[model samples]
Target: MNGILNVLKPPGMTSFDVVAYLRGILKMKKIGHTGTLDPGAAGVLPICTGKATKAIEYLTDKDKVYRAELLLGVSTDTQDAYGKVINTLEVKASHDEIERAIKSFEGSYSQLPPMYSAIKMNGKKLYELARSGIEVERTPRDVKIHFIDILNITGNRIVFDVGCSKGTYIRTLCSDIGDRLGCGGHMAFLVRMKAGSFDLENALTLEEIKEMAREGTFEKMLTGIDVVFKDYDRISLNEKDKNRFLNGGFVGLSEGKFTPAQKIRVYDHDGAFLALGETVSDRNGKLNLKVDKLFI
Candidate 1:
C-alpha cells in the first residue's frame, strides 16, 4: 500500500470520488491522486498511497496525452457537451480546413481557462464561482501543445490525439479550434490515454481492483516509490555518508562532476533507497548534497 496505483478512472466519477473509493477499499488514510480529471472523462489516474504521497507534485507536473472529440456547430457555457447551449453556427469548414486549424495550435501559446474549472482566484475555486453565476476576468496562461494529430473527422465531429504540457485544457483547445473554423464547438467526449509514464493500457478498473483485494493479491499492482524518479540519476552513499544523510547532514562529494541544484536519487551502502538529494555549492565552493525528500 506504499506505492502508486495506476487506476483506470471511469467516467461520471469525480477525481476526489475515486480517491475516496480507494480509501474505503484499502482502509488507508494517506492516499491521494496525482492530478484531477474531469468527472465526464475516463483515463489513467495515478493514485499514490502511503509514503508515495510525497511524490505527488513530481507526478502531476508530467506531460499528458488525451484523445478528445470536438463537436462543431455548437457552443456551450462550460465548453463541454454537458453544459447549456449558448450559441450555434453552421459548420461549413472543409476537412482540410479543419485539419489545418487543429494543426495551427501545435506550439506554445497563451490559453484562457474555462470558467467551469478548478482554478483558484481570490481564495475561491473558479468552479464554485461559476456555480454561483459569477463570472470573473481570468488571464490566459502559457501552455505548450507539443502535438495535435487528427485521428478522425466525421461530419461535424472531429477526433484528435493531443500531447500537451501540464496545464493545457482540451475543452478550451476544442473551443479555440471551433472558433478558428468559424463554427463554435464544444468538447463532446474525452479520454485520457496517458499521464507521464502511466498509460490506460495497464490501469486497473475499480471492479478489478475490488476483485484483487478480495483475493488478497492487490499488492501485486502497486508500483514502487522509486518509479516516480526513474529519470533521475542515482547515487549510493557509503556507511558513513548514509548515516550523515539519514541525520539531515550535508554529504561532501570528493569526485564526479554534478551541476549545481541538480536532483538525484540517493541510496545507502546496502542498496536501500534513502532519499532525494540536490547538489549544491557549499560555502567554500565545494560540492555538497542537500536532502530534498527522505523516503525512509
Candidate 2:
C-alpha cells in the first residue's frame, strides 16, 4: 500500500475514477494518480499510494509514449473521433506527403490546446466552458515532440507512434498534421504505450487487480519507490549521519567530487532507501548533502 501501482486504465474512465476505484479496493484514503489520461483513451497510468504519493510530481514530469491513429479528410471540434464532425474533404495528399508533414512536427513548437480539454482558465476548466458553448482565446504553450514513427498508412488512415515531452497532445498533433496536408483530420484512436519507466507490458487491468487483492498477493503489483531514482548516484550514511539526515539537517560530505545541486539517492546504514538528496554548498563553500525528498 506504500508503493506505486502500474494500473492499465480502461477507456471511458477518467483518471480520478481510477483513483477512486483503487481507493475502494485497497481501502486507503491516501491514493493518487501521476497524470491524467483522456476518458476516451486507455493505457498505462501510474497510481501512488501512502508515502509513494510524494513521487507523483517527479513521475508526472517524465516523457510519455503513445500510439495513435490519424484519420485524414475529416476534422472534429474536439480534435478526436469522440467529437462532432465539423469539416470533411477528400484526402489528396500522397503517402510521402503525409509522412513529410508528420515528420515536420519532430521538434519544439508552440501548440494551441483544444477547448475541450482539462486546461484551466480563470478558475474554470476549459472543458467545462466548452460544455457551456463558450469560446475563448487560449495562449499557446511550447511543447517538444521527441519523435514520430509512422507505423502504417492505408487509404486515408495513418497509424503512428509518438514519443513526446509532457503536455504534448496527440489529438492536437493529428489535427495539425491533417491541416498541413491540406485536408482536415482528427485523432481516430489513441493508446498510451509508456509513461516514464512504466509500460503497458506490466500494467494490470482492474479485473486482475481485484483477483490479486482477493488472493492476498496485491503487494506483488506494487513497484518500489526507488525505481524512479535509478538514474541518480547513491550514498550510504553511517548511523550517526543517518540521524542528522532524518532530522532535516545537512550531512557533511568528505569524499567524492559532486557538482552543486547534483541529485543522489540516500541510503541508511543498513542499505535501506532513505530519501533523495542534493549537493549544496554552505556559506563557507563546504559541500553538504541536503534532503530533497524523504521517503521514510
Candidate 3:
C-alpha cells in the first residue's frame, strides 16, 4: 500500500471519493490522489498510498492527454453537459469550418475559465460564488495545446483528442473551439487517456479496485515509486555518498555532470529515491549539490 494505483475513476465520482473508498476498503488513512478529475469526467487517476503521497509533486508538471466530445449547437451555464441549460443558439456552420477552427488552436493561447469552475476568486471558490447567482470577471490564463486531433465530425457533434499542459480546461476549450467557428458549443463528454506516464489501458475501475482489496491483491495494481520519477535526471550514489546523503549533508558532484540544471533526482544504492536537489558552484570553483527537498 506504499505505491501508486492506476485507478480508472468512473464518471460521477470526484477524486476524493475514490480515495475515501480505498481508505474504507484497505483501512489505511495515508492515501491521496495525484490529480483531480471532475465529477462528470472519467479516466486514469493515480492514487498514491502511504509514503508515495510524499512524491506527488514530482509528477504534477507532466503532460496529460484526453479524448472528449463537443456538442456545438448551444452552450450551458457550467460549460459542460452536466450543468443546467441557460442558453441556446442556432447552428449555421459546416463540418469543414469546425475542423478549420480547431486547427487554429494548434499551439498556445489564452483561455478564460468558466464561472462554475473550482478556481479560487477573492479567497472563495468560484463554484461557490456561482451557486449564489454571482458572476465575476475571470482573467484569461495562458495554456499550451501540445497536440489536438479532430477525431470525428458529424452534424452537430464533434470529437477530438488533446495533449496539453496541466490545468487546461476541456470545457472551456470546447466552448472556444465552437465560438471560433461562429456557433455555440459545450463539453459533451470527456475521458482522460493519459496522465504523465500512466495510461488508461491498465486502469482499474472502482468496483474492480474494491474487489481487489477484498481478494487481498490490492498491492498488485500499485506501481513502483520510481515510476513517477521518470522525468527527472537520476543520479546514483555509492555507499559512502549515500551515507552522507542520509546524514543530510551537501555532496560534491562531478563537474559537467548536470550543467545548468535547476532540479535533479538523487537516488541511493539499489535505486531508492532519496531527495531532490539543485546544483551550485562553490567558492572552490567546483560543483556542489544541495538538497532543496527530501523525504524520509
The C-alpha lDDT values of all candidates are 0.92, 0.93, 0.85
Candidate 2, pairs of clashing residues: none
Worst 10 residues of 2 by lDDT: 252-261
Task: Give stretches of model 3 more than 4 Å off.
Answer: none
Tens-digit lDDT track for model 1 on 1-296?
78899999999999999999988888889999999999999999999998899989999999999999999999999999889999999999998999999999999989999999999999999999998999999999999999998989999998999999998899999999999999999999899999999999999999999899889888899998887888998899999988888898999876566778889899888887788899989888889998999887
**What C-alpha root-mean-square deviation, in Å, does candidate 2 show against the real structure?**
1.0
Compared with the true structure, what per-residue lDDT tens digits does model 2 show for residues 1-296?
Answer: 68999999999999999999988988889999999999999999999988999999999999999999999999999999999999999999988999999999999989999999999999999999998999899999999999999999999999999999999889999999999999989999999999999999999999999889989899888998988898898999999999988898999987566778999999987888889999999999899998999998
- Which is superior by TM-score, 1 or 2? 2
Candidate 2 wrongly placed segments (more than 4 Å): none
Counted clashes in each candidate structure = 0, 0, 0
Where in model 1 is the C-alpha error above 4 Å? none
- Scored by lDDT, model 2 comes in at 0.93
> How should the candidates be ordered by lDDT, best one leading?
2, 1, 3
What is candidate 1's TM-score against the reference? 0.97
| lDDT (Cα, 0-100) at 277 in candidate 3 | 69
